[model samples]
Target: MVARERIITTVRPLDENRIRGSFINCSKGEARRLTLPRLTEIDWSEVDFLGWRDPKAAHNAYLVTPRGGEVIGVALRAAEKHRSAVKQSMCAFCGTIHAATDVTLFAARRAGAAGRLGNTVGTYACADLACGLYLRGKRRPAVHNPVDRAPLEQRIERTLDNLARFLDEVTTDNAR
Candidate 1:
């Protein structure tokens, strides 16, 4: 019997120009000014999205993912106060369990006029913004859950769904 190879849907590798052009929630100047991760150091096939925290500015994080066949980026800010590590938190994007200190509440302004008017959306996510890596088993959390027996594909789909929903919340104008 032959073993079946797993099919993975990996995000395409992006150039700095494409990444800098993908932001939907921030000004062109802001996008240009944001620090970028080392693109050359990444293995694009192992990730479903490109996410990172700004090393120069601790509170700033960014996510760039493919949506509707186009790349879109969003700028996020971490909450000033962190929850206690005694409580375990599940990352809404990847379902990875983490000590509360490893997860954070990040807020992104809405796109267009809504954002200009101060509308924002937020979610609790892995503090390092490495949900794709966590879901793929490329990285491990401090505490492990042996009971989450879902197949990798299913978990990937769920994470993608959660991400899409959050992106919609950030880009959609609910006032309409």
Candidate 2:
């Protein structure tokens, strides 16, 4: 049996330009305040984007997504969850069902004054934004798979599309 290397490099890590320019509402100051994750902290072979919660700002989260050959970073405000835990939850971007504790509410800043005016877009996202990893099977869910499960490639594409759609939403509001 030939041992097939499962992961091909479909995604790349983001550079400073990609990270700074990724956000619609982030001020230059805010972007400057942003911290990049250390290479040691991530398994680059598995992730499509770089995402993490701020160590200094617990309610803050960040994501950088790649399109074509370029990347964009998004700033998000994570909403607090219930003290009580539940058995099942769903990740809005990846749409994978998970334990309630696995999903967290993430609010992205609106593109313009709507955001400064206190308007934000939110979703129940995987706590680490590791949906790509989950979809790619680099990571697995806490539960068993559905009998009617789709192909792995299809699931990865779907997750990527979902993220692109969310980025479009952020950009669309920026155009306003």
Candidate 3:
């Protein structure tokens, strides 16, 4: 397991607008469906990274990486909350929506010295992107078109890559 510390810098306050914009731009068309919670509502002093679901696609979450008070990348997430007695997790990437037993979470971890030396956090999502439905106008497989699948996958992949780059940038900056 990796241990990460929340970011706590009194001199540099997080730019809420910048972070929101980064998340919005990274989301592209999905931005229209997302709503960012107020920055003031979050404990910035204790947050190394912040993430939430798209307002439109509440099940689809995103994580933002902060470096030098600027947000660099956004990672997409898929999670599900159950309504039964026991809480369960679902994959956002795959179409298989199941109980916790069937779902697995995948997260990206910070690597290198910055990860090992600084406050580094990991991003997690469903191994399968079932949660993508929230973005595709809540269209389930029964009503989904084959054409929509490819583009959504591409977007999710791009989001993940962007997050990796952000982690790399953080590592590089910390090294300097």
Candidate 4:
């Protein structure tokens, strides 16, 4: 097994250029034809990381390095589950609110050898996108989502940029 060090990366709000570039690059063939979701609809604050579900496989979304948008890593978002937990639950992607029972967790993995060959790992997220709600302040107890998708040239660029920001945060945190 290749020994890898866990790097603490910071999360920042994605800029317009990065978002637009990612949309352009990731949209390949039908993905391009598909109507892109509104950026405003995406809850940016609660987004722990940008991820993608593999093109060949739809089961997993892998945490990607914002730099080069490479599937260099993976992560998961889990809801704090307890019998005495809060009453209102939120979805990670859409920022919708629902009862705790209405929420489910989803898991995804990054595509390519880097992900499958053990260089990286898969992650889990809320099945209903409660994290989205937390980011947008639509719900309480902010949640996160695990996202993954096929390799896109532009997405890779966005991933690189995102990763850089995350790394910077980690470095800063370590110093503190």
Best by TM-score: 1
TM-scores for every predicted model: 0.90, 0.79, 0.38, 0.33
Model 4, backbone clash pairs (residues 3+ apart or across chains), number: 37
Per-residue CA lDDT of model 4 for 13-132, tens digit only, reads 554444334431122342333332344665554554554344443332234334333223333323344574765554433334555555545432223333243232222234433343
Q: Which runs of model 1 end up more than 4 angstroms from their true locations?
A: 1-9, 83-86
Provide the lowest-lDDT 10-residue window in model 2. Answer: 1-10
Residue 100 of model 2 has an lDDT of 76
Model 3 alpha-carbon drift over 4 Å, by segment: 1-13, 24-29, 79-176
RMSD to true structure for each model, in Å: 6.5, 7.5, 15.0, 12.5
Q: Please tell me which predicted candidate would have the highest lDDT against the true structure.
A: 1
**Reference-based lDDT, residue 175, model 1:** 57
- Candidate with better lDDT, 2 vs 4: 2
lDDT over C-alpha atoms for residue 38 of model 3: 67
* Model 2, CA-based lDDT: 0.71
lDDT of model 4 at residue 98? 54
Root-mean-square deviation of candidate 3 = 15.0
Higher-ranked by lDDT: 1 or 2: 1
lDDT of 3: 0.44
